[model samples]
Target: MALNLFSRKQAEAPPAIEAATLRSDRFRLERQSDWQRLESIVTALEKNRPGRIADDDLLELPVLYRKAASSLAVARETSLDAATLAYLESLVRRAWFQVYGPRTGFLRWLRSFFGGGWSAAVRDLWLDICIALAVMVAGTLVGWLLVAGDNEWYYRLVPDSMAGGRHPGASPEMLAQSLEGTEGAEGLTVFAASLFSNNSGVCILAFALGFAFGIPTLLLLVHNMAMLGAMLWLFHQGGLGFDFAAWLSVHGTTELFAILLAGAAGLHIGRSMAFPGELSIMDAAAASGRRAAVVMVGCVLMLVIAGLLEGYARQLVQTSEARLTIGLVMLAFWLAYFLLMPRRAMGAKVDPA
Candidate 1:
């Protein structure tokens, strides 16, 4: 009885091993042609040596990848031999990249962004921009009126550190000197860094606080511009309003514009969530977030430009005319670029740009 049991066990093991070997061989033979073709195409693509792959092979890449992926799944379920499973996996990975991976390099993506992608995105948010602009204007007026109604309001609106010696009822001489870029080279460098940090913080915060229907973003914008209004009223009272305006404009043109875009971007996300329309809230938010993110990237670049203008150019050029010229030129350039660049790239008329 023991001898019979041993013979039966040995016989069963041989049959099982033969079945597995046969399955692996059959699987390979059935898909071997596709696997080879996919491997060739993937190799050519990886080399980035264009014109090496035939047009037909390029078109068939996706199909071949899907087939290989399917085979991998089957091989695992059937417990195919290790070598065959490994080959399928390797082939599938290489083929998958050629079929679906990103083909655009960094340069290509950068060109696309600055060329028209950014401006087009901005155009889409024009409505939000208008709304944000209106709210900012209103906030500025509120600050000005508050301070005008009571001088004490200026202190409340403007921090002592920022106000320095320039405050309500400050003599015109001191206020004028303040605008003359009296800060030395080292001081200007430090001031520029500080301005960039502060401005960037406000812009990012405005953009990041869009989830609660954008109320916080709106409030933040109002509060931020209120400080500007207070300072403006103070300068005007000392009869240095025009000088202060020119000073602020030099960098404020770019800095304020960046803040405007940030507020708009935040509003867009909140608006999408508030009114998802045909899509679910999550879907609407996801789509709007993508669009808003593009706008925010451009805003960051604008803020950096603003920082350089404020920190260096504004401090170096003491003349009001020169400051105004620089500010207006920057403003005009931004308006034209955002309004015209995309149309020009698309071969459209440049009217109103």
Candidate 2:
């Protein structure tokens, strides 16, 4: 009777062993539902459709992401089934990005940057801007006076290629023709690209050289303004001062403004680094760099716009009055955009509601 009872018990033990579950299987099954829910929400969010995700899911994103991350760690440690491990790894990665990775699209970022970020940065450098502007004005006057006191100074101040025969000795017809824009010039696309590249290079250099205590930046501003003044004096001598002014105004306003911004940005960084005050030099430079970067970006944009005007509008718009009007209008638009546009942090989004 005892041997028969023992045989029956042994037979029941085999059946119980056959019904047992593996550790990996049990682990996966217990959390599969949560993983599925997390994946669905992640997929919905990935589409970037504004209203597709429910409010509850949005609120739950961090929690879901954390749970999946924890699950992945456990799976790696326990050597779970290959399929389960792979699935969790992928799910965790995608969920992590959705939770913490960059969310702003290019267009949205651009709108925020141009809308207020650039202007606010510029405004913060107002003192630097004033100093730069004063230096430029002084440089211009110095060039003009130097040339006026001695015509020989004109040759030294202005490059021959840039002068394009518009020296003091040139007749009014020759000087006026130079201001006639590229009306007769060929390959305007090439001309515009070249002009843009040259201007951007100067602006970029001015910005980069600010680390040298801004002395290079100041010198660059002086050099640029001196050329302008020399040319202005030359045109004035030719009796076409208004025509020359109009031609320059069309593109010069934008171009010069861009230069001013670039110079100020350089000065801002240099000043901050020099007089860190309470902050360390590195911290001051980093803070100033952020602001200067915004100004430099806008400076490049302004250069592009100036290039377009120099290439097309300056040539197409014939009348002096028209040129003046357009230049002044663009100046006004830039001023209003910088001073009056809606203000916000650099990359902050508007409330969708």
Candidate 3:
């Protein structure tokens, strides 16, 4: 009689819930609702399959997952049965795996760690160096114009301290005598340390001057260039061009490269200030600093290596041609590696910072 009454009342009993409902449970289960909802979703999804999902529809999985998740929570809280819980668990797991579990291994790790915009960072660094080089060339031209034909240009520009009392461009015997005086281990140590300290100090100054928006960097570049040009002219004046070139090139190649790198770093900072792009001046400065730091670290390493080469090899090597060849080769190697190597292989690795 009750069955007949319920059947008859269904026609009059407001439609049963359109969605399934479960009884409330006193105890909470970890992810239990989620698991149940997942299964229910998959079943419903399979029933309503509209062929292959389009790419745009795939992107909506996150939203679908959330909806399933909410419904599952409601079911779990209201005492969903064991079967329901298991189904929800399966659903959540499959969804999660589909979303995140495909890519794995060293390549994935590499992509995550080094995938940021490092190529652009390194390119900007190279650009900064190129601009600095242009500035350096301008300075060189200015110096040449100032004293191009003057006989005393060399005397005025070359510092006495730089030549180590070897004259502006000493003869073979004079060069030999200078080397003989500093050949001992003690003298070598002193000479090496002094040169290292001086060169390193110059590099530091070049880097630090970036705080002034490149004016200081430009000034220092001009000063150094004028001094160098003057010294070269002096060697020519003294008819010791070959000897001086060999002597200076022995280590100057490395030393000068280091200085140029430092100057480039400074210019990078200044350029960031001068042209902030989408960033504020402060933001650009910070970005530039990070890039500059990489170059500066490389520069310091070069300086130390240059110091070692200059200290021991420059003095001991008597043959001018040999020293010149070695110096040129070292310079070429550094230039090719830093200036010509692919960006991805160079500074575009992980932690561009």
Q: Order of all candidates by TM-score, from best down to worst?
A: 1, 2, 3
What total of clashing residue pairs does each candidate reach? 0, 0, 7
Candidate 2 residues 1-353, lDDT tens each? 22234334434554444333256556866887788888888888788663887898889888988899899999889776556677788888898777776567789879878878778888889999999999999989988888888989889988887788878888888878777755554677777888888889988888888888788999988988888888889888888778888888888889889989999999999999999999999889888887899889899989999998888888888889999998998899888988887775676322211
Best-matching candidate per TM-score: 1
For lDDT, candidate 1 versus 3, the one ahead is 1
TM-score of 1: 0.81
Clashing pairs in 2: none
Residue 138 lDDT (model 1): 89
| 224: Cα error in model 2, Å | 0.8
Where does candidate 3 stray beyond 4 Å?
Answer: 1-123, 141-156, 163-186, 340-342, 345-353
lDDT of each: 0.84, 0.82, 0.66
Candidates 1 and 2, the one with greater TM-score: 1
Specify the poorest-scoring 10-residue window by lDDT in model 2: 1-10
lDDT of 1 by residue, 1-353 (tens): 22234334434555658776676667777878887788888888899865998999988887888898898999899888767777778777777666666566778767877899889888999988998999999889989999999989988889988998998777898888778875467777778888999999999999999877889999999998888999988998988788888999999999999999999999999999999999999888888888898899999999989998989999988899889999999999999999888531222211111
Off by over 4 Å in 1: 1-16, 23-40, 49-79, 343-353
